[model samples]
Target: MQLDLTTFILEVLNFLVLVWLLKRFLYKPVLSVLDARQQRIQGEMRKAAVLQEDAARLKQQYEARLADWNTEREIAKQSLEQELARERDTGMKAIQQSLADEEAKNRVRAASAIATREAELVRNATSGAYRNAAAMLRRMASPAMTLAILNILLDDLASLSEKRQEELHKAAHPENVTTMEVVAAHALEESAQRKLGDAVAKVCGKPLQATFKTDTSLIAGLRISLGESVLHANLADELGYFRSQDKNV
Candidate 1:
């Protein structure tokens, strides 16, 4: 509590010296260490920022590549689907065309078969008709029928056209034709033969020699032969003609 100037002054001087020693050794070294640590921390922070920027750029690039891959996959899928559809259509059309062609061929074959069968039936029917006609005519043949047909033949020769008469005249010329033969299915009376000879001579425009014969195979009417020319008015010849026509059918 008493005033001690000299002692206070000595204490103050010792305290100042201690403070100077501390600043020179401890304080200076501690400040240097703190500054170095601060510098190192700042360098580490800058490195971290650079790493973050690189990571962001890499992520963006990965995202862009993924989008492009997705687009390409979609396009490939659509193209494959279109190609499959086109192939299916082509196959279906080919099958349909083949089926149509087969159907047409079958129809043609059926039509041909039907036509052949019909033609055969017609031929059979016509043959039967001709046979019946021949049989009926054979049953009706007789001497009386022959005489009647002979009269008709005489009438036809008498009424022949001018052109036909000329043909007969030329064919039965006296020098070329030695004899004009007349054959009948039945025997003829002398008066009938003379009348027939006179009628033939008149048609030939000159007198002609006559010869007569009989054959029952004529069935009816007469046959007149002059050289290579022969004329028949007979049921047998008629029936034979019908048979030939049937065969043609």
Candidate 2:
């Protein structure tokens, strides 16, 4: 068990050589492999992070497009609704105007029909009244009444102004008619005729021929016809004038 300095030194030299070789051959290679694996891992993690960021950007773009589409659809729906409402209001106004026009036409037609009916009734009543009055007047003629009316006619001729009397006398010219016709509702007595001729000559300023006729339609009066002019003092003529007034009413 004596210490061997040479052998111990050799053993120490061999151990140092072995440590250097292991460091140069095994530890360096292993450390290099570990560094490459760590670099690949880091590169993969960086690529994943970039892909996730791209996916998030795409998702945001899709969501924004969807929101825009929804807003456009809502706007289109509101526009369509407003258009439909305007159309409905226009249709309603047209219908109301048509109804109002039809109602006005109906009212006008009704008023026209009513007015026509009233006019027809008035015409019928007027005709009936006129005929009845004429019949009653014809039934009341008398010779005494006729004589009284002739006397009144002679008095009226006498009372005429000088100008009217001259006009009447001129109308009974002897060239157109040699005689003036005197019509009565009844025949006159000879004495009455002579008296009437004298009165007629006094009004005419010259004596003229005379003719007489009996027409009961006069009711009770005298009518002296010379030419176009006729001196009428008759109930029938008065009744006709009154009938004209009534018809006008």
Candidate 3:
């Protein structure tokens, strides 16, 4: 425990020299490595921040694009549905119209067939009635009926209008007439023929050299011919006129 000043001084000097050496070699190099590492870490952090920002922007863009695609798809789907609906409606209408036309045609055909059948039935009934009347008239024919009809004919000739008398006179003239005849279903007496000829000649304003003949087809009356004109007071002619009217109906 004696005071050793010289030794203490040397110890102090050595300690100080060691400290300087450590600071210059170890501490300086270690400090440089730490600073470099710190700068590299800071640069990496800055790059990571930029990458994160870019990723966020890309995500936003993708989301927006996806939304636009969904909207377009919905619009396309709606348009297709609307088009199909219109086509379906048009097709249904067309089918309905065609069915209506066919039904109308069938109705028209049915009406026409019914009308034809009714007309045919009417024609058949009328023809049968005419045939019955004609048969009855043929059975009723007799000489007395013929005489009565001839008398009636003479009365009609006597009662003719002045104009009709003049027409008969012109038609029965010798130059115009080719043949004049009195036809009957029965034979007449000479007195009756003479009386009829005189009456006819009086109407014609001249003598009519009329020839008389019997024709059973006349049925029950007289037929007087003057040129193209023929006057009949006969059952057969009356029946024929009625039949012609029926046929026209």
Considering every candidate listed, which one attains the maximal lDDT?
3
Tell me the spans in candidate 2 whose CA falls farther than 4 Å from its real position. Answer: 1-116, 161-167, 245-249
Tens-digit lDDT track for model 3 on 91-135?
Answer: 888888888887788878877787667667666666666567666
Off by over 4 Å in 3: 1-116, 174-178
The clash numbers for all candidates, in the given order, read 0, 0, 0
The Cα error of candidate 1 at residue 115, in Å, is 5.4
Clashing pairs in 1: none
Give the distance in Å from residue 135's predicted Cα in candidate 2 to where it truly belongs. Answer: 2.9
| lDDT: the better of candidates 2 and 3 | 3
**Model 2 lDDT per residue over 60-153, tens place:** 9999999999999999999998999998889888888888888888888887778667766776676677677677766767888788887887
Name the candidate, 2 or 3, with the larger TM-score value.
Answer: 3
Clashing pairs in 3: none
TM-scores, each model vs. reference: 0.54, 0.53, 0.59
lDDT of each: 0.81, 0.81, 0.82
Q: Point out the higher-scoring one by TM-score: 1 or 2.
A: 1
Error of 2 at 96 (Å): 8.5
Please give the lDDT score at residue 83 for candidate 3: 91
